[model samples]
Target: MAVVVGFIPTPVGFAALEAAQREAERRGGPLIIVNVVRDGMQGDPRHADQGQLERAQDMVRRASVRIAVRQEHTDDDISDVLLQVVEEEKAELLVLGIRRERDMASHLLGVTVQKLLTSSPSDVLVV
Candidate 1:
């Protein structure tokens, strides 16, 4: 089975990528990095640019594990797209990055993370 990770351009997203790579190496499986760009949202910070995608790919390559990067533009819900990839890849684990408010005592999960946590067919890890 593969290890799937949701990647954006943020630090948290890179963290998730690193975690997923380690997991993939541990499991001796391939890594699938899914970067989703919401359709008609060119200005969205959540979407990764070409440079960012290349950087992520390079990072994974240096890890010496098999990698497949899927950068897609979609109008569907982010969680749904990620779940679909996980299903298609037959992923054993799904990794995601979540933002945390420094002022809050507890970190609140994002909409996508919440949805995936409950709906994903595989196990999930949030960084």
Candidate 2:
């Protein structure tokens, strides 16, 4: 139905958006970006400021492709939110921004990344 992307304002996040947009265009579907902030998170640069969000919207506008951006702060885990959006939109693909893992203990390859990879119902693209 659409390409759902987990978005922040980070470099990997931007990369995910770009790749998802291209994939959506190729699939003839719209792009849906889910920008999220974990509840009570403070000063996390990942959460875009109003200016940054507006800029992202402007960029999407210039790209001239059908897109929907949803920003929210949730008490639930980020991975859960992403998976929920995928089902809500009936997304065929899920794009995510990922950073390399540092250790092999319980921490795992970024907890949320691992969670989403294992749990999402749609095809996942880690950018």
Candidate 3:
């Protein structure tokens, strides 16, 4: 099973990516990075640009495990997209990143994280 990580273009997201890479390496499994772009949110800061994705790919390539980066565009809930990926990939673990803001706990309790926490078949890790 792969290690699946939800990736956004943020510091927290990169941290999650790194952690997921380590987990994948430890498990001798592939790493799948899922970057979901909400419909009409292509310009959103959270959506990663091609350069950023390339950089992320380069970072992951430095490790020994295989890597796949998927940039999915959808109108559905982000959590749904991630859960679908988890099921499709038969992921052993799902990792997410949360911003370190004043209301960090609120971000942790957000709909996407909460949904995955309750609904995902694989283990969930938030970094």
Say which candidate scores most in TM-score: 3
Where is model 3 more than 4 Å wrong at Cα?
none
- Evaluate all candidate structures by whole-model CA lDDT and list the values in order: 0.87, 0.81, 0.91
The per-candidate count of clashes, in order, stands at 0, 0, 0
- Please provide TM-scores, in order, for all candidate models, with all chains considered together: 0.91, 0.87, 0.95
lDDT of 3 by residue, 1-76 (tens): 6999999978889999999999999988799999999997657887998999998898888878889999998998
Count of backbone collisions in candidate 2? 0
Q: What would the per-residue lDDT of candidate 2 be over residues 1-127, giving only the tens digit for each residue?
A: 5999888887777888888888888887688878888878888888887777776666567554588889878988888888899999999999887643534443346678888888989999877
Ranking by TM-score: 3, 1, 2
Cα-based lDDT at residue 26, candidate 3:
90
Give every collision pair in model 3: none
For model 1, how does the per-residue alpha-carbon lDDT over 11-116 read when each residue is reduced to its tens digit? 8899999999999999886999999999988799988888999999998887656899989779989889999999998999999877654522233345666789
Order of quality (lDDT): 3, 1, 2
Candidate 1: give the clashing pairs.
none
Which lDDT value does model 3 have at 86?
96
